[model samples]
Target: MASQADRVAEAHKTLYDQGLAVRTDVTGADHVHRSLQNGSSDFARPMQELATEVGWGSIWTRPGLDRKTRSLLNIAMLCALNRMTELAVHVRGAVNNGASEIEIRETLIQVAGYCGLPAGLEGVRVAERVLDAIREQQSGEKSSTAA
Candidate 1:
């Protein structure tokens, strides 16, 4: 069997090469990469490992689905599962993968039809938070440009 560290390193390399970078949501990808590199046993270690191996390596690296489409599927699934927190994380990832707010909104609407109204509503709520933050950042950029 492949060692856990090896799997993580491969996943990290794949993610970097694909240009799918994580934002500064918490500790950042570098911190997680180091922890995975050193084989640390912190509280979130398991999740980090799973993210590297399963989320990044296995699923995200698949060539059949484009990153944007995968992100849309992830958002829909997370919402259906009532995973609000992880949903937010993927929402950010989706935006990084070139998913526009309008696309996300349409996805949420589609999820509503398939996953139920509550699930879709929760997705919209989380997506709105991310969208608002992005809008704020853009407005700040515009104001700074004018100055």
Candidate 2:
């Protein structure tokens, strides 16, 4: 049998591959690649590896909920938890998973009522930034294609 560290390494790779596939499918290859490379410290690297194994491998890969549903749930939960940074990332994920801006707006409104005005406001701000970035990317792509 593999050692604990070895097992974790294998699991992390498997989960990262699976999660990256889903993430890339939703957010596009460029965005997902950029997000995964956001951290570079030794500590950050190990923590990311561990998170990939547990968060993606253990939970996100589980049966029942599809990636779209999971993305929405993640947005809501991150908003409630006051995790703006993660919320921003999931906003992009939500879009990749086929969520419209209107749907995201509605969800934020609902979040405000349940999670408090402050959290809801922050979530909306983060969502706006992510949406803007997506639009910019899309337009850039269109321009490049047209050129």
Candidate 3:
């Protein structure tokens, strides 16, 4: 059997390949590692380790689901679970993975109709932030090219 650490490393690598790894600027592997290894009593280490391994590593690593589908699934899950904070992160990730503004807006609109206005509103806010980042990046690229 794979050692526990080896399993975790494999999971991290898988998530990285699928663009689902928590970035250094985001959750960083070190923080995730620490949390998995030595989180508070309320935070079960074994379960957390499994989550980092299987959840982030295996499921996220599969090539079957593209980023767009993953984003949609994340939005639905977030709405269902009332996980707005993580929803926002997924929104940004969706944009980084090439989801168009219209697609995101449509997803949010659908969520609003079914989930509730609050969820939709939060999704919109996240979408706006992601869109702004994309626009800024585009502008920066243009300016750099012209210089």
Candidate 4:
């Protein structure tokens, strides 16, 4: 009984839901929830849906690589592109996906050789900031648990 447009909308929604699950699993639930909240505006909703359905749904769900590899690749690519903000976000994602700090450092080192020194330096700075925040958060949890 659904109209053509309705069916397409439902399909897109399905992809979005799948993407949400995959993204949350990779990035942690709280971060995914906050990102969804920030993209709730009408103007931003389209971009959100596209990123969810396309980037997360299509590419992230592929079987060619594991999540950790994908996260590392993103960090490297973001560093090459000089996308520092996205680099920071993906640094967190890389950590969540089990990438070690050393792996991130190595990736940046590779980037410096290919992407130019300035971009690599900025990427290192951004990655360190995210890593510090994550380290601090983990320390807080450990202290609370100990107390």
Q: Estimated TM-score per prediction?
A: 0.71, 0.81, 0.63, 0.92
Best by lDDT: 4
Clashes of each: 0, 1, 0, 0
Per-residue lDDT of 1-147 in model 3, one digit per residue for the tens?
999999977766665544436332234465455655574456575566556556665665567987567777777677656787667667766665667778778888888888888878877887687678768988999999999
Q: Candidate 2, residues 1-147: lDDT per residue as tens digits?
A: 889999967766888777666555755777656655875577577666565556766677799998778888888899999989888878998887888898888888889999899989999999999999889999999999999
For model 2, state the Cα shift of residue 70 in Å. 0.6
lDDT by residue (66-130, candidate 4, tens digit) is 99999999999999988887788889999989999999999999898998898789999999999
Backbone clashes, candidate 2: 1
lDDT of each: 0.76, 0.81, 0.68, 0.90
Q: In terms of lDDT, which candidate is stronger, 1 or 2?
A: 2
Ranking by lDDT: 4, 2, 1, 3
Q: Write the per-residue lDDT of candidate 1 for residues 50-111, one digit (tens) a residue.
A: 56655665666678988788888988889989999878877877887889888999999999
- Structure candidate 4, residue pairs in collision: none
Residues forming the 10-long window of minimal summed lDDT in candidate 3: 19-28
lDDT of 1 at 31: 46
- Report residue 59 deviation for candidate 1 (angstroms): 1.5
Off by over 4 Å in 2: 1-13, 23-38
